[model samples]
Target: MTNLDIPATPGAAVARTEASPVGRVLAEQAVRTAAAWLAEFRKSPSTPAAYARDLGLAAVVEHHQLQDLVEAFPLPSVRTLFTRSRARGVAPELCWFPMLLDLGLHPVLDATPAHVKGWVALMDEHRDATGQPVLSPAARARRVAALSSLLRWAVTEELITANPVDRLDRDRAGLVVDRHHSPTRGLSGAQLDLLVWTADRYPGPQRARTAALVALLATTAIRVSELCGLATGDYFADTGRHVIEVTRKGGKRQRIPVPPAAAARLDAYLATRPDYGAVAVPGQHGAGRVPLLATTAWRPGAGRRGGGQPLSPGEVWATLRRVARTHPDLAHLADQLHPHQLRHSVATRLLEAGAPQQHVQDLLGHVDPAMTQRYNRARDQLHNSPTPLAGQLLERGLAALDQDQEHHPAG
Candidate 1:
């Protein structure tokens, strides 16, 4: 039996634990090693909460009987699972944690193939309070993939004899199927037009800003994260085209060309700033720190001032929702509209307009051309639908037959 001391904080009494060498040994060294790895995996403050949660789970498993923990684990209520499933725009990592915690299957040496199969079955049987399936097929596959990776790592470290998850058939696990052929997710042309129109006329302090944001999103197709991260210095005129430099997902910086209409709206909105666009200029010393879409700052007597701070991603999402709800024309889309959908709409529109596949891929900052190809194929299918063409042909043939009968007096 090894004694492990886990300190809550500096100068605090250490919490001591004694490991049992029986079923599913939760080795202290393994916990310590995983903790160190997870700490190093922390990319930003935004990510530490998740790492801490993972570490906490490891701690819980360390102090408990593995079989007892699995059997007595309090699974998340069906209502809670449904609530999480209904949420839009949740981070993928965040979505996996609760489900993983509910399973209560800790990584340990004694964890067997049968145990893993049981866990998978439990997931398959999970239903919402209303008796609807909680996890979609794609979502189930994603959870399994995340678990498989973790178990594969444990196997490599000799913590487990084999990965039980690897033994599960891919198709049975809801993986390796044609799940990608689902309907295209984006606003139609009319919905998009109404959305922009509403934003342009939105009655509030955020009117101009919202309008500019909509135009920029529709044209540039930048991710919401990249859009929120834009500083004053990020936009500039290059040659005859207006360009905005953005750090895309995975830390790759790229310059995206802004359409003339979007660029004009953005410029007009910037000009209305209290600083007259001076704050957004890159080389203007302290002014370069100004956010392109700044949050409103309220003071005791200063009323409201814009351009003090950058808008958070949540704030951006809320703003779009607010605009959708406020405008009668866009009310139908209030629940469905989101920033990423704008990205999808742009990709689809560009592909339909005959833009080269590689160019569309670059515009969307996609690393894989295969993703862009999906959009292209969807556009082709929409245009080449036989139903509409067949209708047109039938109409023409009927008109010709009517004309012949009229000329020949067919009585």
Candidate 2:
């Protein structure tokens, strides 16, 4: 073979390190390095990391860095981060949470068995009245999505080289298609009349206030938060029509024209409005004034007050529940009624009344015209049922047959 050189085989001599567990320890260290980087990235964002979060977890989640993100970003703990991501406003979840800890990251990414167990325990505590998990099929999906977001945030922060949750079957983890039928199911006309009559059954300021709150929800379709968030300034009376401006989700604002009945009730309530420091600025007028809803709980500059102060969401819900129990007509409607249902009811009624789609969309502050179309389509089904018309035609056809029978008298 003379001086011919031989090419070395790929695995000819694998270098064997005599150091026991050296390879394992190095791999472990690499994982921890990635995890620590991820944690910092979540608090502080980077372009590549953010892109990973967007692509891997959720579409709505925007990247935020520790420097740029709010100090009170509300990402306090892992649980809170999950909850805020899932619950705040009507945003969708990212899909990377279910398994991100599997990748090597330090701190946030290190999957302690205790952490998983604690999450499962906490989730179990969120059951509804029926004791079925309140984090229903839909909610579980949202939770998973939220988890995915945090993991993706980890990736964005460079905690790991790849998204651990990238292949997580979000659909299997309860993130399924949401088909929401409006649960407006408000009081029927007669039922509403009965509720009013029941309200009238009580006397004095208590009756007035209760009636006003009920009327406000039913008529304005304002959210419970917006209703409770109200200050005297929210209502405008002098301009031929009364208008109440409500702050909705996403910090969006909408001005709803209140009917005379609700306006009258609101006026009555305002006349008795106590000084929770929620007065209207006389000359300025409309929408930009203080919050329409206020409670003594959040009194201006008051140190702190608990339940002794004015109403909270729970307080308002409880009070409304009590009112429902008092009235037979409203009793059935009470348990089902929420402040949001009032908004849905208003949207439904408006669409039913042939209100313009654009008008409804604007009134509801829907970001998309398609949302208004949904209500319009539903309203059409309610008022314009073809089945009923078909039934009437069938009856008329039978009547003609009856006349022929009388003429022929065939056995």
In terms of TM-score, how similar is model 1 to the real structure?
Answer: 0.59
lDDT for each residue of candidate 1 in 201-269, tens digit (9 for 90 to 100): 789766788888877776667777678767778788655566677755434556666666567678878
Show the colliding residue pairs in model 1. Answer: none
TM-score for all predictions? 0.59, 0.53
Model 2: per-residue Cα lDDT over 1-411, one tens digit each: 011122222322222132324333333343334334335434222222332232222221221111223223322222123222332222222222212211211223453334333343344355557887654454455454444555566667776455544565545544463444432455443344344445544454456666667666655555565665454555664345666655455434445566555566656765665552444443333333443433445434434533223344455675566676785557777776555654565566556656666666655555556665333221111222222222233234345545765899656
Candidate 1 lDDT trough over 10 residues, lowest sum: 1-10
Cα error, residue 113 of model 1, in Å, equals: 5.8
Where does model 2 exceed 4 Å of error?
A: 1-131, 142-167, 183-186, 200-205, 237-239, 274-279, 282-310, 373-411
Model 2 root mean square deviation, Cα atoms: 16.6
